[model samples]
Target: MSEEIGRVGGPKNVREALLISSETADRNRHEIYEFGPFRLEPAERKLSRGDEVVTLTPKVFDMLVMLVRHSGHLLEKDDLIRSLWPDSFVEEGNLSNNIFVLRKALGNDREYIETVPRRGYRFVGAVRQLPPTGRNAISGVLEGQIRDVPSRQTRRGWKILFAAAAALLLFAAVFILRRFRGENSASSPNSPHLAVEQRLTSNPSDVPVRAAAISADGKYLAYADPTGLYLSQISSGETRRWSLPKDFVVFPRSWYPDGAHLLVVRDPKHPLDSSLPNPSLYKLSILGGEPQKIMSNAWGGSVSPDGSRIAYLSHTNAGDLWIMDSDGANARKVVAGPDPNKGGAGQDLIWRVVWSPTGQHLAYIQAHYRNAPDPVEPISSLRIVDPDGGGASVVLEDARLGPVALWWGREDRILFSYREDPANAQRNYGVYSIRIDGRTGKAIGPPQAVTRAEGFIEGMNGTPDGKRLVLWRLRVPAQVFISDYDPGTRQWKEPRRLVLDANENLAWVWTADSKAVFFVSNRNGTWKLFKQAIDETSPEVLVEGPSISDPRLSADGTQVLYLSSSNPDDASFPAEVMSKPIAGGTPRVVIQGKGIGNFQCAMAPSTLCLFSRDGGDYVFRVFDLEHGAGRELLKLQHQVWSENGSWSLSSDGSKLAIFLDQHRIRFFSIATGAAQDVTVKDWPLQNGDWGANSQTVFMPSHSPAGVPVILEVDQTGKAKVVLQGKPNADFGWMIQSPDSRHAVLGEYIPTDNNAWILNDF
Candidate 1:
């Protein structure tokens, strides 16, 4: 899994790469360094070990001086790349080659150059700075040491240029360190009662903090807002906006061990689900510069404690855990997933892959759906594994434990967010901790609750010192809405919000008379079926459950339909189709199975309801309303690592359109036993439904970056954009009422997220 900026072959040695980097160094070359037996002269661009002179290329000479200058501190691989080839894009192999040559030139002193695994090379031998000589009292460094192309001929201006370069290293270095540590003072030791909570940002509801991370020293905060990316001084509250490229979508994930750079992710449309468009992982300086690309299609990149490697999840690979050198080289799979060779049964997700405090193990959540498309949440376990992929063990396993967020602090203690109440309050998610015995990698005691909140803590990050923590909280709730629609003209207007509350409400099936709407609402703390009339305000509870979802109507429109997982406390409960008369009564089990997916029904005159199961393939069967099961109608090969396809049933029960591939739809005729292919030409297709006329299909889609649009496509594959949606919101499901005058759409309203600091962790 080694990701390189460029994989092309490089010159055999540094001198053969056609790189000349010492223009500024040639003028400001005043510093001389000595380490072990090797002595380096910047003014003369020379190196020697005792009586023997070391032959070095220009770039190799530059690299040696850099390592000696920052002897004890880390020089990130990206930093070295920019310094070595500031104006050009070169394969990472060139840098590796330079180091290899330099190490060989240094001879028997194997201890001189220490490779930091994933990070970069470090000069481990004791280094001393020699007195300034040659009439030059000051030296400077730009991206390590000022660079210029190599020169085969001698410079006539060497004497004058060497003394002309002004001072920068001593003064700029001190000023930068002070500014980075703004009013940063050591706080009293961390204690439970002394825990202090502070709000770092005061943004409005619409303008939210996208993502954030604290500096290694706990003095600076880097965050992204609607306006732009910014860095804020914690103690002084002074914030400055980073000059990012227009329309850049970057979120700071964590800081490097050096405390001068941050690793960030770009175009992360869906952070939790890694099956979407590719996202980028890169590094950028807090002092401001162009981002240096590291890896593509990577997410949740959390650096190890030593900053030598990064643990990230692959996007298209669906939660395959991987670790790569901090330099984006020598990547290895840390955890074996669904064999990439087979890659098709179903994907088990891995997320929040953070390193343990000691850097020996990685803590993450393993989410698996025994029934991959069960509609219910997946079973999640808080687990850890050694960096070498050994000593794997689970710390916490429960039906209530989900994948909201996770973190590791001091003393082998892991803090995570879990659902506290079964069906009482989803918003009451609380933070809990399970202590692991460091030696055995197993839980030491029962889990303990750290804190409870009225809103969900979407994410968590801790300072390097382990004395502070930062949380990103989300409180936005979902609601059902209706809009007047004229499908012929493709116009939507006079929107009306229904069942308004602080809980989530998802639009589903309508009633027999089309006068009321039947939907799923979390108003009572758990998802249950509710029926509300178009003219009424209050909703009447129809199906009370420990939990239920994917509500629909019977073929005859006489019974309400839904799926219930049977047991609330069991993670392996199989979902069963439960039905009750439209007027309401005791629910009866109609069908029982696992891995049930999207299903739909037609009205009275047509008794066609289709049910599907996703596993080895997409199996669609003609289901009876009154009976338990029916015969299989069709099955299609499931595309691995791709979004599951969606289908819509025509009101007349004559046509069924299934959407799965990027551009084609399979339309099946129930009466003729004939199927035709309809292709969408506007853009890659997304979730949609059968149009009222059965001659058109309406699709709600968003761009790779999340700009919403509605498209109307016809049988011939011709299409046109009907309308565009709001900028900040995303669509869930769209359905039209039986009467066709109103349409119901599910929209996840934007949330106001801010960074909160907890001191004395």
Candidate 2:
């Protein structure tokens, strides 16, 4: 009976054989697989629905592939864990999180994956082998059926085939033509234009335009660079520099509604110092005159639409949002941030407040503390509150790395600038807008992109009419440099560029042998570890993956330690400390936690490494790698804006030198946990590292003329100038060799920025 229905060597046999051969070829090639409407390409490490690609994290993608590979079979939890995290210890919660994210990515077809209570997971969906070239498997069956038809049916089959092919061709042609026309209509030179962009400032010196604001009348622009404040007439292109008190530095924040006066933040001392006392707000007129003080201890301020009230942020232990009368009276805190006594863990800052045009509401940005658990949820957010501080709510959460300028536009829309990926914020920033649902104080619509500029957008402000936007574009290139220090002459030789790359190359440390240096760079889109010999011109890749930071070499010259993360764009992703052999090998997980910062190990006789973790406070821990154990050594009070390299390990690993708040340094004994303050009269140390013999620490200082110089501070709080940086250069992140003969420094080349106006944007 089976032979009568279908005989061997007939058309059906040929088709079956062809399909079997195709399946064999697919398995050999390890190409795409099909389950329902989804196609999984194992070779490409990608999944797709028809022609659209799906995005997934590295681990999540791997888990999905494993499930599909063992379809119809239950995968034990232990088995799955062994397969996914083969080299490291991962908690069960992490596996559950991946499954949850995978289910969400699968959308409506997530039911294909089933769970057995307290057992494991099973992929029950029917999956088929697909051709390596992505051809439809059903099409092959159809072709076989047509060919197997009797002689009399051949003409009809051919006609049907021709008609179907013609239809598909016609549809494809129409789609292509429509797409071409749509693209051309939007950007073609012949298209009717609605707006034009104009360049306002042509700075020949390449000095960055630091802060900028547009006047209410939209006729003038006020900007500050390294030199001083400058006023420019937008229409006539005339510019004039304003004269101010000598040595006084100020940044332009906002303008008065009348357009003739501006609100600025002035710092008589070091402008970059976060703990500067009473950073006062002043009103400077467009015409030359002595500035009038508006309020002390305030920074970013915005005038109300009617100019009756001023909303400003006060710089204190707890950053507070305050509102006062136009003349700086009746100041009251409207939004209170984290309390100083509480360590300001998550609720640290309120940034860049702006009053709405109607004066009924005020909007501002809030910064997320770095030590969060969700990895991506706490970068920054947008909030809207009633001017009286009632009914305050977050309008947008997890808005990527901000301090982004906000402008309330027509139709209740709030426009701001943000980078799509916070990990690459240095290169990408675009303007986006979302409308607010007024009654609920929530975002109404999805964020729509206004412009994706090529360069970085530093600051943005819109005109009163909301027809133009003034913004600064910046491009900075940083390189690594090495200098020779002569202990005999007590001087440093001119620094030579060490690692030459267009991308940022930041120096981390010198090898224990002092023959090569290791650094972290983003030249390949993700920050990775690279090493270069002292005499080499180019660097060789040492470790490549998601993102790496704070590379450190072990004191015994046997291991290299660094902090790494799978999702570098998200701060909530806990950074794990990993170590490998100095000569190179598979990296082994050493420490796993959230907010792991820079680390340092003892140079010679000690096998101890000291690292810091940011929770509510900066906690320092000592890890004994040889014993495979760690213990908390000390904890420092958290400062809102403390530098990452604020602590260093002594050479013998017996003590740690920590820079504390108020320009103070503390020497803590590692053995007894005793602490003593080392007083340096008036020097504000920005960056420092321990010198040879552990008796003195090398700290970078600036001369009165602002030239970079290095000062060696001894245990007795005495310091003297050891090396001075070249004129017109900035030195940061100093790393000294144990022998004290060579030093590696981070030299920041000034980035050129230009101001441009986007008309009708």
The TM-scores, one per candidate, come to 0.70, 0.71
Most TM-score-accurate candidate:
2
TM-score of 1: 0.70
Residue-level lDDT of model 2, residues 322-441, one tens digit each, is 999988899988998877656663355776788777878998988765642212233678889887889898888754635556777654888776675565523456677788988888
Global lDDT scores for all candidate models: 0.70, 0.70
lDDT tens per residue, model 1, 1-761? 11111111122222222122234446556556777687877668889988888889988888877666555434556667777777889888899999899878887423466554345665656677666665465554432333564354435455445544323333444432332222123522331222223467767666777778888788989888667788989887799998777767788888887888898888645342234546889898977889888899887889888899999887667567889999899888888667544634335678678888778889998776543332356577888898788889888887677675788877578888787676663545566778899988789987775654455676777876677777776666666877777867758764578877657777777886778888877765666788888778898888876667778888788888887776634645666778888775788988777666667888768888888776567787887756767998877766522355567888778888877555777778888878888767536665678766677777776665566666777877887766567755666666777777777777767655677777765
**Cand. 2 TM to true fold:** 0.71
Error of 1 at 371 (Å): 5.3
